[model samples]
Target chain A: MKAKIYITLKAGVLDPQGKAVEHSLHNLGFEGVTGVRQGKYMEIELATEDKTKAEADLDEMCKKLLANIVIENYRIELE
Target chain B: MKAKIYITLKAGVLDPQGKAVEHSLHNLGFEGVTGVRQGKYMEIELATEDKTKAEADLDEMCKKLLANIVIENYRIELE
Candidate 1:
């Protein structure tokens, strides 16, 4: 099974890296870009074939290592 | 309009950050994990309402600034 994970900063949290990208885009004359929020994307291959088990493990992985729960949020998709 | 961009290392390209994450997962006893790839995800808000124009602009942004096309690949999703 394969898992796709997305880790993003929570609403109300400031993202300096995202701000830098937005600024750069404007400098490059992409004036239509009004906002940018950056996040982490991870693809993981799991040995288990069980979808339920994979989802549970992937969720644990996100909580334990992939995401900082205090300021970030994580979502997982399995295939 | 909103755009979701994903930037990932091309196949066969070495990813040290991904390796580190994989190793950490192993140490943490996520033994079912077989592989890991890390990437960047960005969400951008565009002032334009035209989807076609937004897509074109986003492609240019990826090529010019958001992605290092030499060793990375990017995908853009617009909504």
Candidate 2:
């Protein structure tokens, strides 16, 4: 099974990297861009074929190592 | 308009960060994880309401600044 995870900063958190990208976009003349937020996208391949098990393991992974829960949020998709 | 961009290393390219993450996961006892690849996810907000124009501009942005086409690939999703 394969898992896709998206980890993003929570609302109200400051994102300097995102600000930098937004500024760069403007400098590159992409003036229509109003905002930019950066996040982490991860692809994980699991040996287990059980969808339920994979989902549980992935959720645990996100909680333990994949995300900074205090300031970020994560969403997972399995295939 | 909103655009979500995922930028990942090309298949043949080496990813040291990904390797490190995999190693850490293994040490952390996520034994079911066979492989891991890390990528960038960006949410971009555009002032323009035209989807076609936004797509074109986003493609240009990716080529010019958001992605290194030589060793990385990017997928854009508009909403």
| lDDT agreement with native, every candidate | 0.95, 0.94
Model 1 pairs whose backbones collide: none
Of the true interface contacts, each candidate retains a share of: 0.92, 0.91
The candidate that achieves the highest TM-score relative to the unseen native structure = 1
The local lDDT score (0 to 100) that residue B60 gets in candidate 1 is 98
Model 2: per-residue lDDT, tens digit, A7-65?
99999999999999999999999999999999999999999999988898889899999
Question: What i-RMS does every model get?
Answer: 0.4, 0.4
Q: Estimate each model's TM-score.
A: 0.99, 0.98
The parts of candidate 1 lying over 4 Å away from their true place are none
What is the alpha-carbon lDDT for the whole of candidate 1?
Answer: 0.95
- Model 1: docking quality category: high
Worst 10-residue lDDT window for candidate 1 chain A reads A51-60
lDDT of 2: 0.94
